[model samples]
Target: MGRELVIGDIHGSYKAVKQILERAAVTATDRLIFLGDYVDGWGQSPEVIDYLLQLKSQFDCVFIRGNHDDLLLRWLKTGEYTEEWFNHGGRLTMEHYERLPADKRQLHILFLESLQDYYLDDDNRLFVHAGFTSLNGVKHEFFTRMFFWDRTLWETALCLDKSIGHNDPLYPKRFTHYKEIFIGHTPVTRIGETVPVQKANIWNVDTGAAFKGPLTIMDTGTKEYWQSDPVHELYPDEKGRN
Candidate 1:
């Protein structure tokens, strides 16, 4: 099988991202898939987006759209509602760009809008930002929304229900086709939080780095996991730093 390393959400913590990649020893022969949320949360949205775009040009990078990314895209498109966007770590995103000049900000906005929703490799591995859809009964709309909004999948993972939250409105049909499904969006305090469950080939790599948890990376084929220190230190006085 090919070398495939699927990564979890990166909320603009460049340090965490670098550590995970270095630990995984990613190479040209290996496929690196990011589950999305590449921006927001932390203060490096501009840097993170620029870095990912560059990596896409040089390496095999697959980026799926996360809810924050989609909201950021919308904010850029029409400058519409900003509550939900900023409330969920969008403040850092704005702060990241507020330091940039107009031209650079426009360039970054263009880059953000260009990201795709999902990527499927020839291998039986699927990379999605959120959870998967239900088998045979749900519509594409449901799947699309869940891709950016589902959280039950993470709970199931924590509960060790490997079925990948089959009860979720978004659990996909027939996980048998893929050897594993790489997902992000849920932030667990432990890497082993996802060790259980059947029916869904899920390998959740979101360790809640932005939430004082380690950033996560895992090899889809080998299921090897790696973690990096949270970019910023979390203390009792700074409970909401991220």
Candidate 2:
């Protein structure tokens, strides 16, 4: 079977993504699953998307849409970029499209819309940009949170609390069982932070590259990880603190 690597949220840190891929030494035979939120927050949104598209051409890539990606896609579908989007890092994304020719912008917007919500594997692994559904079918609270959401699912699993349920059935059983879940969105001070529970299944790989930290990547089967420090500071205050 091919090796699978899960990557965390990349808020337009194209260089950081490149560096992490380099450090991981990803081969064409390997599968790289991105947890979404590929654009916004930092600059270089267009450049990052371009790189991801290029990677998709060479490697087996599964790009799941985070809330931000979903919102961006929704906006692009209407051809209406609103003020709410601009206020929450949408300005960077808008600038990315504006920098390109009109035709290219239209094409890119379509590309964003085609992304799916999540990627699942038979090996008891599920990759999402944020939390899963609650028992009532309501999305986890983090789905509405700006940017990537917290690792609350992991915490709830550790605590064995059913009240933490989301509307999404994907989360309930997995949370109860010890399945290795790879997610990005929540920033961590270290390259990889394991939930410190028995089996320690949850892995948080967002090293805050857009916020003056390193971008991270991890191999699910081997438990191996790689990271690359920020090429330059994008937002000093947001590093690992967000």
Candidate 3:
């Protein structure tokens, strides 16, 4: 089997995403699992989605839903924008879509609608855009929103003792169901790191592509990783998410 590669949020940093993919030497045979937040930050949200759609045609790809993506979908369906969404880089995404042809816009909307809340491989490696609230397997219908917004699961993981065995009650209940959990949405830059970070069994790969950090991608088995240059460097003229 090809390598199983898990990627963090892109947040419309198409240049960063492209650089990381090249650095990882991604092949058609590799399985790519993208943790969401694909849009709403940089100037290339539409281009990022376009590239992703092309990638799906060549690789085994799994796309996760994220809070920002949800906001985009909500606006696409209702033609309404919440203040929180517009203020947080959503305007850039809207501008990109508005410039596209009607058919192309619909295609991107469908792509966002088709994103999965989470993915679990046969090896018990779980991939989610954001942390899930329940220790149980993903409840897509009931906790879909949480899958894109929750952070407590990661905070709990960071506090728990990793040496504890799964059977131990002292072990984090949130991690009991999976061998490893890969996630994005909570950028590692918040902890002053610009690279993928591991806390217990959870791997946080988001290096804040929406802000001024790199984009990260990692091999699920070998724990090897690759990253783009700081996103700000890629688009020197843009203000990004400030």
lDDT of each: 0.68, 0.66, 0.89
| Predicted candidate 3 versus true structure: per-residue lDDT over 116-136, tens digit per residue | 989999999989888877666
Pick out the ten consecutive residues of candidate 3 with the lowest summed lDDT.
134-143
Error of 1 at 150 (Å): 2.1
Count clashing residue pairs per candidate. Answer: 11, 9, 0
* Ranked candidates (TM-score, high to low): 3, 1, 2
Pick the TM-score winner. Answer: 3
Q: Residue 20 of candidate 2: its Cα lDDT? A: 81
Candidate 1: 10-residue stretch with minimal lDDT: 190-199
Write down the RMSD of all candidates, one decimal each.
4.4, 5.7, 1.4
Q: Global lDDT for candidate 1?
A: 0.68
**Which candidate leads the pack in lDDT?**
3
**Residue 213 alpha-carbon offset, candidate 2, angstroms:** 2.1
Candidate 2: regions farther than 4 A off: 79-84, 136-151, 154-174, 189-200, 231-242
